[model samples]
Target: MLKVYGRANSINVRKVLWMLDETGQSYSREDWGRGYRATGEPDFIKLSTFGVVPVIEDNGFVLRESHAIVRYLANKYGRTDLYPADLKARAVVESWMDWAQTDLYAAARPVFHAMIVNAADPATAVAPTDGVKSWAAQMLRLEQYLTGHGPFLAGDQFTVADIPAGLVVNRWFTLRFDKPSLPAITAYYDRLSERPAFRTHGRNGTP
Candidate 1:
């Protein structure tokens, strides 16, 4: 069985869980990070030196980093449709995955950290406002991408690319920031919200 170590509410962990659910793979989840940091304990640290929440123990392979874990799963367990077998199609999805980590996280982290962890009102946080503005602007880029395709980031077919973006959408909505008109992103979220995996992950608010 695959063992996942992370708190339920974590966006990173949520992405991994969502992907697993999408793949219809069963795994064990452990409470860790934020409310619990088992990753910091000597035993867990021996496995994941970074002490991150989303550590995956599959068979004997121990891996950390949420995005990497999901990508690994997509390649290993995902139907070729999700990860895709064609090089160009796979590249398209993988590009979004990398963009989510590099660009989306850069924009969303400050807003999420201030609003959720610092317990500061988003309206009052200068960094969060700036961060949200950046995030919303970045979302416009995604909106443009999605505008050409319905219901999915990569295209007509849903893929692993949607997983992290879905988690980011939850954070964006929760922050209560004034988002620029993004019909495509909104529609995408609406679709994702209907998924059982997203609903299951939504049960607990971020810690």
Candidate 2:
């Protein structure tokens, strides 16, 4: 059986867990890092030099990094769908996955810190107003991407692109941050939220 080590509430961890659910692949999970408090263990450090959550051991082939995990699973389990055999389609989907980590993280970080780490009491938090403003703008761009394709970020098929971005989208909707007009993003979020796997692992928006 595949095994995953990470805290359930972690955004990165949620990316892996939600992808597994979407792929319908069963795996065992252990709590690790940050809120779960197992990040510094020598064993975990051995597996991941950075000691991050979302380390997976699949038949002894260890893989770290949240995006890699989702992509690995998508390739193994969802070959023609989540991964896409067509080169162009695969490139399109992977671009969003990369964007989620690179571009999206800048917008997502402060908002998540303000809402989850400091607790949603804005007065006590670092005041992520600017962060949320930036996030909302990026989300508007994302909404345009989703709406342009109608339902999915790429097209009719739900793919690995949705896994990481879905995790971010859940936080964007749940955290009480001031957001710009986003009816399209709201509709897109509503569709993703309706998925059972999304609610089970990613929707709580705190980790």
Candidate 3:
């Protein structure tokens, strides 16, 4: 059985859990992150140098990083539908995944820090105006892409690309800030929400 280490509320950890459900891959999970076990401890540090959540151990193989773990599971389980085998098709999916992780996540972090993180602890709140502007810009880019490509991030098929993309979309909608009207992203969020895995892990109001 695969052993996963992470907290349930973590966005990155939720990515892995959602993928596991999507693939029907059974795994046991241990809480190891904020408000739980400290990931900075030596035991977790040995597994992940970055001391992050969502590390996985399969047999003797240990892996860190949520995206890598999802891709690995898709490949190992021969879920070509999720992580296509054709080089070009896979590249398209991976490209979106990369964009989600880098560009989209980069834009989201500050807004999340300002809105969600700061809301909990007033002492740490930063002005959300600038972050919201940057995030809205990135969202406009997403809106344009989704308008051009209707169904999923990687065209028609729901792939690993949608995992990160869906989570981010959930956050975008769930955040309690005034947002620009984005019809395409709104439909995309609804589409992703139709999946059971996504409902359970992606958009169950955890934003």
lDDT for each of the candidates?
Answer: 0.80, 0.80, 0.89
Candidate 1, poorest ten consecutive residues by summed lDDT:
198-207
User: Which tens-of-lDDT digit does each residue in 95-146 have in candidate 1?
Assistant: 9888987898778888778776786554565445677788888888888877
- Write model 3 residue lDDT over 119-151, tens digit each, in one string: 776445554888888888888999998998859
Best by lDDT: 3
Candidate 2 lDDT tens digits, 1-207: 999999888889888898888878789999897767678888899988888888999999999988888888877875677788898998998898889878787788887877667666644555467887787777878877766676878778778888878788877776664567777777877787788888888776453
Model 1: residues >4 Å from true position, as ranges?
120-127, 202-207
Best by TM-score: 3
Clashing residue pairs in candidate 2, if any?
A: none
Q: After superposition, how far is residue 129 of candidate 2 from its true place, in Å?
A: 2.0
Which candidate order results from sorting by TM-score in descending order? 3, 2, 1
TM-score per candidate, chains pooled: 0.90, 0.91, 0.95
